[model samples]
Target: MQKFNVTPLLVMLGALGLTACGSSEQEEAPQSTKFSLGVSDAPVTEAAAVVVCFSGIQLVGNDQPPQSFTLGQDSSAADTNDLCRDAAGNVIPNTRGIDLLQLQGAASEALISNAEVAPGNYGQLRLDIAQGSYLQRLDGSRHPVQVPSNQLRLNGPTLSAGGTFSYTLEFDLRKALVDPVGIPGYFVKPTGLRLVDNSEIGHLEGLVAESFLINNQCNVNPADERAAVAAVYIYEGLDLPIAELADNGGTNTHQPYASTAVFFNNDATEYQYAIGYVDAGNYTVAISCDTTDDPENPDEVNFIVTKNITIEARQEPHQLDF
Candidate 1:
């Protein structure tokens, strides 16, 4: 997968300062602005749950004191319900545990809502992740999921007064969540995490016909035991050469921006996948029957079906079926 250099993007965004229009004589600008932030995720295989405990969220900018919000302290923030706990099964205090799996495909839980912050160009937004974060396997075994330095820092958004700006941090777990060999736990890197303006984001969801999966020699029976299942890989831009399309990990000409597993929806009597919080644009979506994709290395996988789709903000979820 293509590795995104977040530093350059953050630097560029930090430089785009919001300028206010007023008289030549400078007047006191509004001291604070309303900002809201949430988080969403893409799916990962073999895991029943991926939970991360967040203690606080902070915004840092030049010439201003960093603004920090403690989870569960804000009345407007979503209730965490003590989702995090100690190894002894005691609930951890002042931390919000979020299961990324529960937030897949356009669904999100607010971390900060309607919070007041100094109106300015912030350079960094940091998440104080606690150490007890973990991942539960399908067999019910759990392993600690560690974040380097117990924090994640992303490019902060430029806030302005008189308006509430909303954003969602998209966690593409396929790239960010890693299971290291010889290690007892998983790790989360910053590569697959993207912070996007809510106004410019869209959602994608669709069905995968059983015949299509069978034709591709995919495992159509959800009840069958398997190493992995079928999945849909999404790439930025349209008409991307099939040869260039690559899965997570290693150097590649083109890498999937996000991917999700196709699961049988018994209630709907169909198989489908939903990808949420995607930036509005044209994209090429590929269906791969061989879904044993590893983010630590490149794999020779087959893409049996491909199609182009467009995502428009505020519109209904873009539906693409195979």
Candidate 2:
């Protein structure tokens, strides 16, 4: 097994396109006017913008696509990228989601109800993931999730009658037809770090690392093997990637950083709350552990924590979280 002897570690952390007819900016005139754009998620890292395309336009950013806005990446924004970010604590750029058409309306109308809207010739977008009456009327067809909204087809210059206006879209990103996989409630094991090495990158201590499927809060049960089926990811810190660790071999990112992970103990229970293998030194340690229901009801949940943690054996295949 791998071990961390020293060094402080931290960390934790995609999209599609649409088509359009316009080739370039219109020559009608460069209308000089200050405009503002808003999406459900802003520059958690990247600057948020409304990308206008041929067939339709939608907002995207902070690692989530249009349909994924309602979805939570992690139980705690401090722990995970809110579930939007990958194991690394960085915010994935493409996660921004698109609004459904049912909620579409003029910025002028929504401003009255919204405090974020600034008074002006606004171009607001509200989407409903559902197959609403307005969506059918606007596109004149039933659009698959892959299809972009028709609003993008509308020329930006002609969008507002007034020269100055603000836009806001409150469309639903969740599919009303299917059950949500993750709800608002969830917890972690040895969250963030597990205090492994005190030197640089702590030498591997050879601790056993095990994984389990738990409810909203991370804890294992003897009779309940059902939760163990959920996928779980192991990490050193919310900010560090696994591929960079010592044994991991530095292949996690564009330019791999030195990274590694190890089993916590002889028994699989070590992976449960154990922070991987901590080096023999003084340091802060952390880990990210999560799972979701196969057919998530997005309703009730609970937490489980024990002193001597051991899992029940079962014939069913165990699932791994990516």
Candidate 3:
């Protein structure tokens, strides 16, 4: 019965206006520049699978218009079953969603590979995660995960000619997959989405000691439930106020730059958390157990802990053990 809180939270191309130097032939058609749009995620500890049905992915450039690339129709990685429908209950192609769970622990899966487009100073990337986006439990039951507006427009990054720009769409599953009070199923708000340039951001990784995991007081767990790290909160500054650590959107001013839940590795002997595509800067990391115990009241400080560290450009995963 833990009420987890996350209070925090690419493109482009070129033209058919071909490049020709008055040559005999059209310079091999300008080679149709490619843009590789990838999909990745921060960790989500609560579910076995966070499956999102991405209908399409597009890139908008400063000079070039928005161009959409075909989704996972050819990849064996995609689930092409008719899980979606139109307003009139007609079935539509389920071409582009990725099981973000499969991309956990800073792993990335390509949504579009060498997608041919007019390359220019691309400013935005659009993702359509329409109806049929859902989650699967460890027990195998499925529940619809609501995506507000169903369209995500990520603004940042630029693509250029003959350059393969790699962009990773990160889904903060802990923050996105939220279970409201008295709500039957989890409702996913779009607030947890991030579009990061993989080449520019740093990575953060660490392990939560067994002592902290042993102290978890979350209301639900199975008999074999061993130690697990619940969530990690990363704030922009190193001097974040202690009060802000518990402030999960209760205050308009306090918010995290990025946040995600922690999960155990395949062996399950130790619990680890990882965050990818983090910008280089100083950040205050807060770790918390998924507990229903109210932090509004005193005596629950152990449920959450904070650490301050600095990350550098293109740095390998920075370690912060707790």
Backbone clash count, each prediction separately: 2, 89, 7
When 1 and 2 are scored with lDDT, the better candidate is 1
- Spell out the clash pairs found in candidate 1: 1-249, 106-276
Q: Backbone clash tally for model 1?
A: 2
Residue 125 of model 1: what lDDT? 92
Q: Each prediction's TM-score against the native?
A: 0.88, 0.19, 0.72
Query: Regarding TM-score, does 1 or 2 come out ahead?
Result: 1
lDDT winner: 1
Regions of model 3 farther than 4 Å from truth? 1-33, 61-64, 72-94, 179-187, 215-229, 264-268, 291-303
Report the error of model 2 at residue 154, Å. Answer: 18
Candidate 1 all-Cα RMSD: 14.0
Q: How close is candidate 1 to the true structure, as a TM-score?
A: 0.88
The Cα error of candidate 1 at residue 279, in Å, is: 0.6
lDDT score at residue 314, model 3, on the 0-100 scale: 75
Model 3, range 130-206, lDDT digits (tens) per residue? 77667777677877776667777767466666776667778766555676667666666556777777777788888
How do these models rank on lDDT, best leading?
1, 3, 2
